[model samples]
Target: MPSIAPDGKPESPGKVEVQPVAKDNEIRKRIADILITTSWFGEPRVAVQEGIVFLKGTTENDEFKQWAGDLAKNTEGVVAVVNQIEVAPATIWDFDPTFQELNDLARGFVRLLPMIVVALIVITISWILARLTVYLLRRGLLARSLSHLLREVMARTGGMLVMLAGLYLVLRIAGLTQLALTVVGGTGLIGLVLGIAFREITENFLASLFLSLQQPFREGDLVEVAGVTGYVQRLTSRTTVLMTLDGNQVQVPNSTVFKSTIRNFTSNPNRRDDFIVGIGYDDSIPFAQEVALKVLAEHPAVLSEPEPLVLVESLGPSTVNLRVYFWLDGGQHSWLKVKSSVIRLVKRAFQDSGISLPDEAREVTFPHGVPVRMIEDEGAVESATAKPTAEPETVATKAEASLQSEAEEIKEQARRSWTPGENLLTLSSSTDDS
Candidate 1:
């Protein structure tokens, strides 16, 4: 006769009832078998009765306990899984009571006590060191003579950098980081996120740091940046304040200042001026040059350090171009004012000497095959009417002509609009759009 298998399906009847019993010994051996076969989960203490497996063991956590119970329940003849897992708490030696524990604790305290004392001593010493370091760096900057703002920035930043690094290592030696990591996700993650989000702020701060370190220009120094010419008024951690030539205040990012090429007009005390003096072709080049040199040298604001230069720089189509170069004391005189004064002086000097000055110039030569125009006479030109002539047509006739012209123009425009590219647009656009 046929019988049912352990899974309740049909099996040979001969295998019926010298039925196996599962107990502690048999279950343990089977569990070991399960472990050997799985190779990932360790052996778990198991007791099986009528194919129901009861699991008992100490494990790291629920996941490990579940894995062990699952392994036992999946073995042959197993019907169900019952887990009674005992979780082991993290082992810390602090609260153990024994002679060995006491001895170990004593030894540990002895070993660590001196380090604690040393740390305290070092901290006091480092505070002194930081103050001394601050003093020395500040004194050095003062001796070399940096701005008060710049010196203060360097002292604070440099001192803090040194002090903070020393402080972190001391906290580490005291096991601060290890203790913090055990609770929740850890302070490391908090620090990492903070670092990422504040990266730009860090860069700007460093830019300010560079500003302090380099001392590129002081307050009231003229600088041109991003097409704005201004005098630097204040420098801060995030931005630099500039007062523009138009008397407007502008704030520039410190990072942009660090990244860009800055032109400091006031860096050098003396500045060079250049301009072209135009005189008619009939005027003498040497005469104009001499007059320009006189004008530049006679200007009180011009510096005596660099000698003035005046020369016939170019021969133009209708004019002689004389270039004048001289050193000016600074923006003590405005650029436009100085330029205007020089041009006026030269113009007056030339008028007094009977020298002619022309406005615009271009070369015109008799090139064959080029068209030319000649006006009849100055009197004829004066008598000519500049406006277009009006035809005396009636209003109805004019309106009709205008209507016909508009119709023709509309048709012509429509024809011209159907270009090759326009055809592509016509094809791609929706029918409704058309």
Candidate 2:
């Protein structure tokens, strides 16, 4: 039967056609010709038998060997392919590829010369703009009252923003818009990571900023903050330094200072001090109060406006406890020295007036029995029973004589220790109550 074509035409019954199958030798020859044309393979051998092709060769890389196998497998009449090509070990270093790469890079650089020039110009202009911005900020009237640290921070931040904007523009001009975006995104990510990693440091930094702006306390001011009572020596970026009454230096973290309650004793010139004084139960409370008030009134350091107070606070086991409260000019007089003087004078007054201040009464018990001893001499007994005469007036100590504030000494010490610029506080701003 004759087969009909797709066009519906009848084929001739006598016409017969046969296509010859490609022999294994022909397939081998074709692959050999292809491998010879390329310089990738060396000493490549090709074999074919029974319509199956075999390939073996040495090439500089596996990619070239695979190329040879693919050529053989694609040849006509090839039933299967066995590729056993080995990658040759490189003996001598090839500098041609390296030279070619360098040459390519050089050409690329030449092509980007105009963009590089533009970027350099942009960087220069950005630098100038940043400097100008900082200069203007420093000289601006709005920033005149700001603390030195705050002003510097603001100026530097503005300059940095300008520089960043310039960088983004330069990247866009260089046809690296994606890189620019990455830089912008990466900056935020990096900042977040750094903030997390250095949490305490960041907290302290922010606290210092607030402290500077708030000006809660000033250098040389007596302050009790973060469980430390001392004269504020200086406020720095990381810590607030203090000189204690004991002449010891203490550095409290700014974060702690900001969070803790700050008691600025120097903020108010008039500061009150109190001490407990106990008198005998039999002693007249009114007489004792009058005597103590007289002593406080006589003291030069005590403020007369807020009349010194002597109130019956609590009754002790053997005595009447009185709380003596007095106000003094803290800025002019040392509260410690003034209080000491007042106490000494009060004690003298009480003693002179015969108002007895006694110790706590305690009953001693004898577990076994009470022992008794009799005096042999009558003179000794008489002398023991006799009351001693009143002693001469004692001279007041230096603390009582001089009630000057100790902050001056602390301030001098702090000044000697650090430069004025290092301190974030200004003496002029110290008086600001707000």
Candidate 3:
């Protein structure tokens, strides 16, 4: 209807033709053609009326129905989309059913229910049995006080793996291949990660196993490996910990322990210790050797199986050297104590025998000159009265001038080459951090 003018004259309404688009039907038809012909599924039942598309079809899923509707809606002049695609049931509905067929169907359902119940029963029973077995085994192993780390990993992983196997059996019985595949995929991914990320960790684990089997050293054993000599305190999966000589707890990688040379001082109950004893050149070499051997033979700890050797090894400038070898039982034998005991005994023996043990060599030489033997006692004698005539100075004065120069030089050298954290920074702490 046309709007009324201000003069009160009614205008005619504009044309409201609403002429239908002729091409709209053709576009919808084109879309229907595309869907039925181009798709993987053979054809779809389609209909259109008054520029509205009604999708009516049998399809595998809602996806195909919506797809058919969308295709038609995208056409030039489609006004609305109506989807009426019904999903086909997987089981065929045979209308003409025989009595035997009906009975068989009932039988199938009944058998399926019983089998499912049986499966649940078997799973529960097997699971209980497995748990009981694992618990028994774990308790027995734990009672023996096995390596803590190994025991923990073994117990946990053993029970878990057994449980996983049982679960897989249950899944298989229920015909859940998809679920089983998911589990397999996850396990494969975990194995891959372990293989790639924990390369060193795996090596360390194997090395730890090797260490346990080898019996090269054990707890409280004094061992030397890779220049870090210490007593074994504990062994973990990745590393062997040691109480170092300086009292620092040192954790060395099992990989390193395996790769390096391992000297186990405590493996054997008896350890042979040897040190060269120096006597004055004038002292009888034969008498000195006997006295040294006698000193070792008198010690209770000395092993009598292998007689200790006390023979002249070398002739020093001021003394006659004799190699004194002795064997002692026990890992706790102190090196300092053994040497001190032998030294004190040797000194007493020599004194009783009227033999003089040579003191340290006192060579008289200037800084730049060749070492010279002093005929006079003035320069060589260690006495207050006798001193170097070049200048009269106290011992402290001479020591300050000479030793201070050495101390400063040592400090300078230390400062120039001393980088304490160089190797420490180079070592990895990522595993420990983790």
How would you encode candidate 3's per-residue C-alpha lDDT over 12-70 as one tens digit per residue? 32322223554545655665666566442334656667877776656655555555555
TM-score-based ranking: 2, 3, 1
Q: How accurate locally, in lDDT, is each candidate?
A: 0.63, 0.81, 0.64
For residues 33-121, could you state the per-residue lDDT of candidate 1 as single tens digits?
65455433334466777768777656655555555665666565667768876767535663544777889989999989977997787
Q: How well does each candidate superpose onto the true structure, as a TM-score?
A: 0.47, 0.72, 0.49
Looking at model 3, the pairs that clash are: 1-13, 2-12, 2-13
Residue 387 displacement in candidate 3 (angstroms): 18
Best-matching candidate per TM-score: 2
Q: Candidate 2 vs. truth: CA RMSD?
A: 9.2
Quote model 3's TM-score: 0.49
Q: Which 10 residues in a row give candidate 2 its minimum summed lDDT?
A: 10-19
